[model samples]
Target: MSYLSQITSPTLLIDEKICRANIKRMSDKAARHDMKLVPHWKTAQSHIIGDWAKEYGIKEVTASSIKMAEYLCGQGWDNIHIAFPFNTLEIPKLNELAKTQSLSVQVINPVTAQKLVDGLTEKVGFFIEIDAGYGRTGVHVSDFGLIEEILLTAKKSDKLYFKGFYLHAGHSYYMPDIPALYEQTRDALGMLKAKYQSEYPELVTRTGDTPGCAVMEDFGDIDEMGPGNFVFFDLMQANLGGCEKSEIAVALAVPVVDINRDRGEILVHGGGVHLAKDVLVDENGNKNFGEIVYLNEYGWTIPDHEDRSYLKSISQEHGIVKASKSLLNSVQIGDLLGVLPVHSCMTADCMGAYLSLDGKWIDHAEGCH
Candidate 1:
C-alpha cells in the first residue's frame, strides 16, 4: 500500500531523509562557523526527532518553555535552555528540574533577574534576552542601564551565572532584506559581547533566529546558535528565500471532504486546529494558508506554476484551497492532498504528532500517540 494509505486524518508526515538532511545542513553550518549548535526543539517537539539531531553532533538543545524542558528531561536531554523569558512563577518547577539537570533561562530585566536570584534553589545559568530589533522581548541592545542592572542583580546569587546575550532577530521572518537584518543583529550582539567580555569572560553569545542563521554566511562573535524551524523548512522560509521548497521536511496530509468545481476550491478536513492559522501572502497578494501538493506513492510533489494551488483560507476545522483547474478536476471527495504549512513550527505544534512517510508513527510531546 502507498504511504498515504496510513494517514486517515489530518496528520503531519515527516520525510525522514529530507528531515535528516535539513538537520545535517544546519549542524554543518554551525560547525563551519565554529559555533555550538543547540538545535531548538520547538519545531519538531518529539524525542524521536531529537534523536536524529544527535547524529549531527548536537548535545545541548533549546526549548521554548519550561514545560518543554521538563518534557525533554524524560527523553535524555539533561542540558536544556529554556529560551523564553524566565517566569518567576515557575520557580518551584524550575528548581525541581534543575536538581538533576543543567538548565538556563532568558532573563529580560533586573526585576525578574532579582526574583530568580531570590527564588532559585538550584544552580542554573541565564542569558540576557536582547531585543536586537525584534521588538518583541528582551531589553534593547543599547539599553545599557537595564542590562547592567540585570547583570548586577544576577551576580548576587551564586545559583545564577550569566551566559551572555540571546537574540531572536525575528524581523528576518518578515523583512524583505535578510542580509541587512543579519548584519544589524551581528553588530548588535558583537557590541554586547565586546562590552561584557572583560568582566564576563566565560559568557557565550547565542542566537536562535532561523532566517538569520540559515542564510547568513558570516556569524560574527556568536558563540552558539539554536534555530528550531530550519529542521523542517516551511513555505514561509522558502518565501523568505531562506530554503527551497524541496528542503521542507514536513507536510500535512488531509482528506478531501468536498470539492467545488465552479469556485475552483477544494475543501479539506484540515484547518486552524490541524495546521494553525499561519499564512503566506502569495504572488497575487492573497493570504495563502499553505502551498498545495499532490500526494504520490513516495510522498508529494508541487504542481507546475501554470497549475499551482494553495489554501485560500481556513477555519477551526476546515481548509479552503484555491485550486488550479487541473487540481480541482483531479482530486476526488476522499482523496488525500499534501499541504506544506506556511509556518512549520506552528503547524507541527498544532498537529502534535508525526506519521513518517516510512509508515512509522512518531510521538510528539502533545501528540495523539
Candidate 2:
C-alpha cells in the first residue's frame, strides 16, 4: 500500500523537497542582501526542520515562547532568540536557559525591561520590539522616550545587554498587492533606521513578516530578517502574491466521507480542529477555509477551476468543499483528498506533527503522540 492508503483521517503531509527548496530560496535572498536569516521556528516547531535549516548555514533562530526556546535549546541550538514580549512570570525558566545558551528576549516597554532586570539571574540579550504600524504590540515608532527608557534600563543592568530593535510588520499581510506590501516594508524599516541608526549605530535592526520578506526586493538597511511562514507558504500567501502556488510545501490529507452531487459539495473528515479557523477572503469577498486539490498516485495537484473546487466552510470535525459537479463525481467516500491550508502556521499547530512524503513521522513541539 501507498502512503495515502495508510492515512485514515486528517493527516498533515509535508513535501521535504518543496520545503528544502523554499528554505534555500529564502537563504539565498538573505545572503544576497547581506543580512542574517534567523528564521522563526514557530512555524515548523520541529527539531528535524531546524537541522535542515542548519544545512544552509543558519546558526541562529527565533522562537515565539520560552518553552519553544527550551525545546530547541535541548536540541543543541545555542543561539536562540525568544521573539515574543518578555514575560516576567517565566523569569526563572529564562534565567536557567540563559545559563547554557546565548538567549535573547524582546522587550516592548520600560516596565517589562525593569522586570527583566530585577528577575534575571543570568546574563541575557534584549531587543526592543518596535511597533512598525502593526498596532498589535511593541512601542510605536514615534515613541522615542519609551524606547530610550527601555534601552537605558537594559544598559544599566549587569544581567541584561541591549541587542537592538525588532518589528514584525504584520500589517503588510493585508496589502492588496506585492507593490503595496514592499512599499509598506520599506517605509516601516526606513522609519526605524532613520530614527535610531544615528543614536545607536551598533544596534541591529531586525524585521520579520512573510508577506514583506517574500515579496520585497529591497530590504533597506535591515541587519536581520526572521520570517517563519515562508517555510510552508499557504493559500493565503499564494493569494496575497507572496509566493507561487507550487511553493506551498504542506497539505492536509483528509478522507472523503460523503459526496453531494445535487449541491456540488464534497465532505471530508478534516475541519477547524485540523485546519484551524483562519479564512482567506477572495477578491469577490468569498470566504474560504482552504484550497482543495486532487490527489493521485503521483502526488496532489491544485484544481484548475479553483473557484468551484475549493473548501467553502468548515466546522469542528467536518469540511465542506464546494466543487464542480464533474470534480465532485471523481471523489469517493474512502478516497484521500488534499487541502492546502489558508495559514500553514495555524494548520501545523493544530495538527501537532507532520507525516513526510517519504513515510516518516516528524515530531514537533506539540506532537500528537
Candidate 3:
C-alpha cells in the first residue's frame, strides 16, 4: 500500500514541501529587491497556503476580485489589494471592507474613478493601472496626463488616497526564452516609471505575473511586486523559461482508464474539467496540453522522468498520450498517471481540493476567483 494507492482517481495532488519552498522563493525575491511582497491569493486559493505565506513575512496580499478580498477578510487578514480593475457592481462590498480594514482597488479609467468617488463611503487606496504593453486593461503608458487628471479628480473627494501605479506584463508569460522575459519586464516597467519625479518619488510602481518577477533580476523602479503562479510553477512557466521542471510543485494524479494501443494513446479519467484547456504550442507549432509522469509505490513519484517521457495532448476530459505504440501497450486501465498542467492557475481552479503526496487532505479554502 502506497500513498498513490490510497488516493482516489482524478485527485489534485500537491507536493507539500515543494509548495512551501515555492512560497519562500517568491517572498525572498521581493525582500532582496527591497519591494513590498504582496503575494497574490489568486494562485493557490487555499487558506493553509496563505498562512504559509504569512509566516514568510507576507503582510500584504493581492487578489484578482472583490470576492477574494472578502474571503481573505473572513480569515482575519486585512491589508489587501484587489488587483483587477474595479468592478462597479462590487462597490457595496468594497465600501463594507474599507470600513474595517485597509483596501486598495485598481482603477483602469476615469469613469471607474468617478464611480469610486460617488459610491465609496470610506477612504480607500487606489492604484492607477497603466497598460504598459500588455494591452489588457490599464490606461496607455503614453497617457500619464490622463492618470494625473483622474488622480486630481479623486483628490477633490478625499475619499481615495493615491497609492501608486500597477502594471502586469502578462505578455511576458508567452515568451519563448528567459532573456525575452527579462527584457519585457525591464522595458515595460522602465517606460511606465520613467517620469516618477514627485516628492513622494516612491510612488509604488509595481508589476505582478510570476514569469517576470521570478526570472528577471532587472525590473527597474518597482516599489512592490506581486508574483502568484510561482507558488505552483506549471509546465507553461518551465517551457517559457520561468523555472526548471523541478520547480513545479503541483500535478494532477489521473488514473489511466483505457489504453488505445491501436491509436497509440492512453486515456486518463482526468479531463478539461480537472485540468482546464490550457495547452502550450511550441515555436514549431507542436501543442502540449499537459506533461505526464509515472507515480510509483512511493508518494506521487516522478520516477526520474524527463520532460517528454509521457503523454502530452488533452481533450475536455480525455488526455491523449504521446507515447510510443509499445509504451502505450504497457499502460494498464487502473494505473495512475501523474500529469503536470500547462497552467496551474486554471488547473487548480478546476480542482476544488488537493490530495497531498503524503496521503493528507488539504482543502482549497479560497472561494472562486
Candidate 4:
C-alpha cells in the first residue's frame, strides 16, 4: 500500500509546498543580508529536513542539546552549534563532540568558562554569549569587559578557540508588535555590538531569534543570523507578522471523536498528546487552543470558525472545539478534522512522525527521551 493510503486516523500532515517555500524564503532573506543562515534544527528534528535545508545552501546547523549535536554530527553534518548553555555534567560528551565534529558551544558565565578551560581539549570552539536584551542565558551586555577576560582565560590553553559573541533576542517574542520588536532588537544589538567593537574590534556578532531575524531589515552590525523557527512558520510567527497563513507548513490531522449539539462542542482524538496546550488569548483572557481550518468528507464545517479563531480546550487525549449550533450538530464520529496548531515547534515535538498532505508517511523528528 502507498504511504498516504496507510495513514490511520489522527495523522500529522505537513504541506510539502509550504515547507519548501518557508525554507526558500528564509534562505533568500539570509542571502540578501550577506549573512550565513544557520537554521536551528531543533525545530524540525529530522535529518531529512536538515538535508532539505542543506539543499537550500544552509551548511551550518544549530541544536538545543549536546545529544542533538552528536546525532547531527554523526549524520554527516560538520558545523554544529549547541545553542544551549554549557552544562558541566555533559563536559565529557561535549569534549567528544568537539573532538570529532566541528563543534561550537555557547557559554554565558565565568564559572562555566573556567571549567571548560580547565578541561580544555583542542576540539571545541566557544562563543561568548552576551545577553543583549533577553533576560535569558548569556553574559550581560553591560559586562563587555568580561569578553576579553573570557578570551584571555581561554587562551591559557591552546586547546580552546574563542570564536566570537552570540546573542538571542528572545524577549522580542514577548513584544505586542513586530515593529516594536524590530526597534528593540535593532537598538539592543546595536548598542551591544558598539560596546564589543570598542573593546574587541575583530570579534564577530551572532544573533538568532526568528522574530528579530525575520522582520528586521538592518543587518549592518550582525555577522550571522541564527534563526531556526523561520524554517517552519507557526501561527505565533504569523501573529508576529513573520510569515503569512500560506506560509504555515505544519498541521494536526485530528479525528472527530464526539459531538454535542446542545453545547456546540466537538471532541477530537487529538489532545495535548498531539496538539499541545499552546494558546493565545484576548484582553478578557479567553483562551484558544488552536484554529479549525477544514474538514474531510463530512461537510462538518465549524460555523463562525475561521483561521483566526482558537481550538479552545484540550485534555490529555481529547481536544474540545467551541463551535456554533449548526456546525456542532453535523459532526460525526471518525470524521477527519484539520486543525492549525498555534505553535508548530510544540506540536511537532509531540508528534513522532509526519503524514504528508500528499499521502506520504515520512519519518520525521528525533526521539528525545
Judged by lDDT, which candidate is best? 1
lDDT tens readout by residue for model 3, 1-369? 467777667888888788889888888888888888887878787777787778888888888888777777755565789999999898998999888878999987888888888888998988888776678788887787888778777877778888878878788875446456556556656755566545335567788888878877866667788888999999888877788777788888888778877766788887788889888876798778887766765544443443354446666777777765445656788888888888898888888788777677776744556
Candidate ranking under lDDT, highest first, comes to 1, 2, 3, 4
C-alpha lDDT (0 to 100) for residue 6 of candidate 4? 50
Candidate 4 lDDT over residue span 92-210, tens digit each? 88777777678888877767788888886656778887775668787876775676677777777667676677878887778756566556555656776676576566666677888
Tell me the lDDT of candidate 1.
0.88
For model 2, state the Cα shift of residue 213 in Å: 0.6
Query: Best candidate per TM-score, number?
Result: 1
User: lDDT tens string, model 2, 67-94?
Assistant: 8888788667657999998888899999
Whole-model lDDT values for every prediction: 0.88, 0.85, 0.78, 0.74
Better of 2 and 4 by lDDT: 2
Off by over 4 Å in 2: 177-201, 306-308, 367-369
- Model 2 quality (TM-score): 0.94
> Model 2 shows how many backbone clashes?
0
Arranged by TM-score with the best first, the candidates are 1, 2, 3, 4
Candidate 1 structure quality by residue, lDDT tens digits, 92-175: 999999998899999988989988999989999999989878899999999999999998998899999998899998898878
Kindly report which residue stretches of model 3 are placed more than 4 angstroms away from their true locations once superposed. Answer: 176-202, 303-312, 324-330, 365-367
- Cα RMSD for candidates in order: 1.8, 2.2, 2.6, 3.1
Q: What is the Cα-based lDDT of residue 170 in candidate 4?
A: 84
Q: Which regions of candidate 4 deviate over 4 angstroms? A: 1-4, 177-184, 187-202, 295-309, 324-330, 365-369
